[model samples]
Target: MFSKACEYGIRAMIYIGQQSADFGRRVGLKDIAAEIDSPEAFTAKVLQGLVRQQLVTSVKGPTGGFELTPEQLRTVTLKQIVVAIDGPDILQGCALGLPQCSAKQPCPMHFQFLPIRDQLNELLRTHTIGELAGKVHDGLAFLKR
Candidate 1:
């Protein structure tokens, strides 16, 4: 599972992509947080990581905020966003939080969780922000409130 920050970051990214595609507008942290139903402060912090990772772009002036270019929206995978916010530990950390858990000495939930994690990684890697945002744009999907 993703941390709240990671979850919010993903939703914010997808929402930004949707908004950009809809209106060709740059989005402010306030708008992004409202759309994603996250706290403004937390969303701002999460966005900083995204900006640092180059997963999203930001500006500083009065018209300043965040926006993803069309090419970026089309190519930025969930994996990149997740890694930016959550680190690669989501891919390799122990399912039960055991520091040493692994195939050699698996946790009780290890086998059950491994396949699910693998599938999640594959899905994240394959699905771009553009694809998910398209679903929102088309009314076929939504980000939870």
Candidate 2:
């Protein structure tokens, strides 16, 4: 299962994705943390990981923080965020942490789950960051979950 850290990290990213794209300004961590209701230090570290993964761009200054690069903005269909912060294994592993979960052996839910998982992966692979901004604007969908 995704941790609270994972949830907050995703929420932070979604806010940044919407903000930087709509407002054309890099978002500061303090502001993001406050908006998303996360601890400042913890959010800072998560933001750093996002930067390192090239999912976000960060600058150091009075008017700086993070914004998604044009390349990373609208991306996703995964139940979680990027594999860099979480791990690529989220795609292949069981959400319940089953040891034998796979197409070959399958965990308990596999009979009902593999197709949905594959669809989610395809969605993540096909979408671009810019695509998300439009969706977010249309319905305010990129909201914190």
Candidate 3:
């Protein structure tokens, strides 16, 4: 349900988590884009949004571009990362866009979706970036060629 920008944004964060953990400095945008295998222009825009939300730090000098702060890494969650790029509205409401989606005025798929949405939301709420990385196990994602 997420956009390419949102997917890249998440990949960028996970990239930062692993890189910052290893390199211990502000990472360059070029490196981040390369690591995540995304286009520079698009990733730049996504990274800008993350910067505005304080989910990442940016620098302009010779040794600077972007990096995750300690607090950002520890405090940010998967939902926050997704929201920073994709927004929270979709994840918070009925996919069908019903105005009166509620327990009393339930949407057609409310019964089927309510529990699923709740679980997904809960997973996002509880899972921190580090925890998510641990589960994904850092570079173990097997994408088909």
Tell me the whole-model lDDT of each prediction, alpha carbons only.
Answer: 0.91, 0.72, 0.78
Candidate 3 stretches with Cα past 4 Å from truth are 134-145
User: Candidate 1: misplaced stretches above 4 Å?
Assistant: none
Measured by TM-score, how close is model 3 to the native structure?
0.87
Better of 1 and 2 by TM-score: 1
> What lDDT tens digits, residue by residue, belong to model 1 across residues 1-145?
7899999999999999998888888999998988889999999999998998899889899988888899988899999998888899888787888899888999999989999889988999999998999999999998973
User: What lDDT would candidate 2 get against the real structure?
Assistant: 0.72
Candidate 2 weakest lDDT stretch, 10 residues: 74-83
Models ranked on lDDT: 1, 3, 2
**CA displacement after TM-score superposition, residue 108 of candidate 2 (Å):** 3.0
| Residue 132 displacement in candidate 1 (angstroms) | 0.7
| Candidate 1 global lDDT | 0.91
Question: What is the Cα-based TM-score of model 2?
Answer: 0.77
Of 1 and 2, the candidate ranking higher by lDDT: 1
For this target, which candidate reaches the highest lDDT against the unseen true structure? Answer: 1
lDDT of 1 at 79: 95
lDDT of 3 by residue, 1-145 (tens): 7899998888888777655655677778888788778999999999999989988788899988777766676778888987778788767888577877988988889889988888888887777765554444555652212
The ten-residue window of minimal lDDT in model 3 covers: 136-145
Q: What is the TM-score of each candidate against the true structure?
A: 0.93, 0.77, 0.87
lDDT of 2 by residue, 41-68 (tens): 9998887876776677898888878887
